[model samples]
Target chain A: METTTLIPTGPPATRPRRSPARLVRAAAWIALAVLLAALPLYIDTAWLKAGQYMMIGAVGAIGLTLLTGQAGQLSLAHAFFLLVGATAYTVLAGPTDEERVIGLGLDPGLALMGAVLISALVGLAFAPVAGRLRGIYLGVASLSLVFLGLYFGQSLDSLTGGTSTGRTPATFELFGFPFSNGGPEIEVLGVPIRQAERIWYLFLVLTAIAFVLARGAVRGRVGRSWRAVRDNEAAATAMGVGVARAKAGAFAVSSAFAGLAGVMTVLWFDILKPDESEYGTYGINVSIAFLAMVIIGGLGSVPGAVVGALIVNGLPQALTLFSGDLGWFGETGGGGLTPILVSSFIYGAAIVVVVLFEPGGLAAIGRRLTGLFRARPREITREETS
Target chain B: MSAPTLREDLVELQVDSVTLAFGGLRALDDVSFTVEPGTVHALIGPNGAGKSSCFNVISGVYRATSGRVRFGDTELTGQRPHRLAKLGIGRAFQNTALSPHSTVLDNVMLGRHALTTGGFLSCGLRLPWTVRQERRHTERAVEICEFLGLGKVLHAPVAALSYGAAKRTDVARALAIEPTLLLLDEPAAGMNAVETAEMAATIRDLRDALGISILLVEHDMNLVMGIADRVTVLDFGKRIADGTPSEVQADPEVVKAYLGSGSEDA
Candidate 1:
């Protein structure tokens, strides 16, 4: 039984070969981090606010990517989870003085976490159906959640504050320090640290945490199972990956991320307004927008989602900011193309282009760029050795 | 429980009168066979002769319509695939089921998913415990890839591999699960003679060195006769012959089933 000849011939070592390109990538990441941290120092309050909005989109897009791109579940329930998160936070943290509405008066930070948990629970609740449905059917099925959110928002007036006049969310605070303007006044590089600047830093931290966690999950066993299920459920199951559990887990995790985005959303707007219809904030359009970010970013690419969010979500905010200076949207009523409208068109075109040119999205381009860089160094080393 | 070692104990499988049917057609009909411990067992037949359906029933991909499948003391007649895996069953597919964009290492590492505990939070948190466990599993995955002679392409996407390499990747992944019974569904389906010989050697190494019991379904007669210790032949979803390789090869029914009794007289 002892087959001496058949044992593995190569070195048993598993350590990845250290490459110069890897070092360059590490340095590039650090440079990107430093740039992000320094933005509040140079950028004005309005632009900082716009950046924060993009970060919210980044968080939502990352979650949507895990679901739609990685796990191969086409979901439009992002908006529903967002509403669930925002509503849960507001109902938990809103001041209880008003008679017409309901409030528990909890800490904002705790409320934020509660919102994520509740949204995840809502996703798990939908998982039985989610686990059964695949592809377009699942996408259409998830659309119902948006309608559910709309109806619940309008009818459950106490919690959601109806559609007309929304409820103001309590200022987000960590420990005893408010992420809002209510804390001790401070100065950073001769700039007064106000609400917008503070929110920018807060959003930066949240987005970083979300991004790091997502990257880790994507490269790990959890990610492996998701892709395995996406590729072949029978094979995955045969390898002891529970098909239903992986699907439900994706839904829950994706919802939790969307929930975090929702908390950020309410904090950014300083209010929680249930949509009057499925066309407003927290509607099908929002779901499509988040999906657009994931698709345009490249399916299953964590960093790609961020780029996608920048293009889809950042464009609108940037355009709105530039509107004062550039005067692009000069007229109000005669179909002159609003910032949001223009962004929508760009995003729609981006989705079409991504589907046509690169199904892998921006991530594939990023891979190709890195692949080129990696290949060049190898050739140079080979030439020198020869 | 810690994984059961092949050196310490041996487990045999029994398929007692397994029947699987869909609507009007019976894929497998009251067929029964046994695989003795630590042997290269082959399930072979002509097209649509219930070869894959039999493997599926045994591996729990398809529930036996009415029959018993016993792996040692465990009854796996109606069990799910994942549950069967815990009972030491790992299966590779005929179609080469591999994640197209994932690196071969990642695909192979997924085999140890059953062995790894905890979930997204444990991994996402990068908790010391989860990280350590993950590292151990990665080492195992690397070792498995090396054993399969695929160490160089560990980081390459599976989509870039040749037909034979991809099929070997499927086997490597199943091996990662450390199953007592490794089911290879047409491992040499798309391979040339040289690749088929290489696969046969790898399959034998898995049994002899790793002490894994193999159940192979193959269409290649030369490869099966060379590698398999025991051969089970099926015709029209019924067991036509089962015994030692030469014994089954010389069987009259299998001979007639294969070269056919002058075709036109059917």
Candidate 2:
């Protein structure tokens, strides 16, 4: 999972624990975190909403990268897991007074955990099929889950609230403080931290946790096992990594992330609306969008996945916000330049550019840029060692 | 870094009349050999002579058709491949099957998977115990790498390594498993003469220092004869000779298997 662009020559003595380059990298990350934490203060509600949407994408993309990139499993069933998560949360936290839908009336915090767990269990159930197939076959096999999700969404109207008019999810709360606007009003830097501001901070915290956890896994023993399984099954087995278990674990973890993203999706819209078609929310298009985020970012790269999510999800939201001011990205009678269409074109082109010029994606390019700045020494070539 | 201590109760690996068949073809027919404890044993045969098949069956990658492989009192045939590591058996591949993109240290750390304990949650959270475990195991892995002369390229990607270096890295990884029995398949397969000599010395040094039994499969006869205490010769899926290197080298059946059976008839 760790792909180094700069190949250093010489002995291990040159590799220091805290090199100047590493300190610079650490400082840069700290600065980015501080800036993101401060963004909610200056940005308007619309912009915060955009950032929240991107955070949702970031969480989902991180999961996909671990499974598809690190574990080397192609999965197209992310949308199904997302649906599972969204439905689970809604049913668990929806008001018991509702006549149309089932509600466990669990606390919102508990419901969120329940949703992620349900999604992970659903993912584990699919692992049997995932274990048998590889590459495109596994991908196609997993796609069936989306159709199943669609069927459940329509058939289980009591649970899904009949796509026409979805159920409203209970406002999320941490202990006594609610994420909704009705809670005790709070002000940060004289900016009234309303629901939008609150949710933005909520998402920021979640995304940061997700990012940190994923990085830890990538750098730890679990990440090594996944990469080992990805590289060679026989060797992985010989190295004492259970091939099937590793694959199943990867699927479960990835699904849990997608589940969290699903909960975020419902919160973002304030409604648990299941997709009517395979092209709507929690549809095949959404699955491909998540894949696009990972691929455009770089397979198996934690931070790269975030950058990918920002581009793929943040672009459309940014464009929509800008169009409100420019008024040129209005929907056409036929198929003209809408924000979604324009953003789609941009990301599609970006994928093509990444594939052609840099198969390593943005992460590799970032490594190369940093390597150029360092200009250490000539890397030991294959010929030199021979 | 302190040297990793070998298990005191090292036991011999016994392959007793193992036969592995695939459909109508018999990859290994009644092949048998015993690797004495703390000694280097080599399985040598021509191309397509079931050397790798024998290795695979013993390593639990391939189950035998009719036979038993026992490491001391434990029956190993029915055990899962992943369980072999737990049985104190560590194997290095003939093709250097280390992950190419990962750093040498990371690849070596994988050998410590069975020894360490942690899952996604514990590792992802970097819990106190997991962190301590990682640091301690990492220290051992670094020592193993340095032992294999991979100290210079410890952080280098396996893909960037030379063929000899990559092969050594594979051995280093196997050593990281902390096994009482080490299975090395063609350790010097694609190496130059100097590299082959170095590998021979390393194998001898490993046996002497770690007190671990080494089972090797090699086409390189010089390295095998130099380091292997006992050599097992196979031909046409059958064990032709098993004895000390000099005794096996003088055996007529072994000569015919390597050269041509027609030579004796002529």
DockQ agreement of candidate 1 with the native complex: 0.48
Q: After superposition on all CA atoms, what RMSD does each candidate show versus the true structure?
A: 3.6, 4.7
iRMSD, all candidates: 4.8, 7.7
DockQ of every candidate structure: 0.48, 0.42
Q: Candidate 1: misplaced stretches above 4 Å?
A: A1-10, A16-19, A375-386, B1-6, B262-266
**TM-score on alpha carbons, each prediction:** 0.94, 0.94
lDDT of 2 by residue, B1-266 (tens): 11234445788899999999999999999988898887889999999999999999998888899999999999999999999887779999989999998999899999998888899988998999998888877767877777778876777889999999999999988888888899999999888999899899888778767878899999999998888889999988999999999999999888887888755463
User: What clash count goes with each model?
Assistant: 0, 0
Runs of candidate 2 exceeding 4 Å displacement: A1-16, A19-22, A330-333, A375-386, B1-7, B263-266
| Residue A248 shift from truth in candidate 1, angstroms | 0.3
lDDT by residue (tens digit), candidate 2, A1-386 = 11111112233332234557679889998998899888988988889999999999999999999999999999999988889999999999988888889998999999999999999999999999999999999999999999999999988989989889988898999997999888798987798988998898889888888888899998999999999999999989999999999999999999999999999999999999888999988999999999999999999999899999999999999998898888887675557699899999999999999999998899999888877886453343221343
Best by DockQ: 1
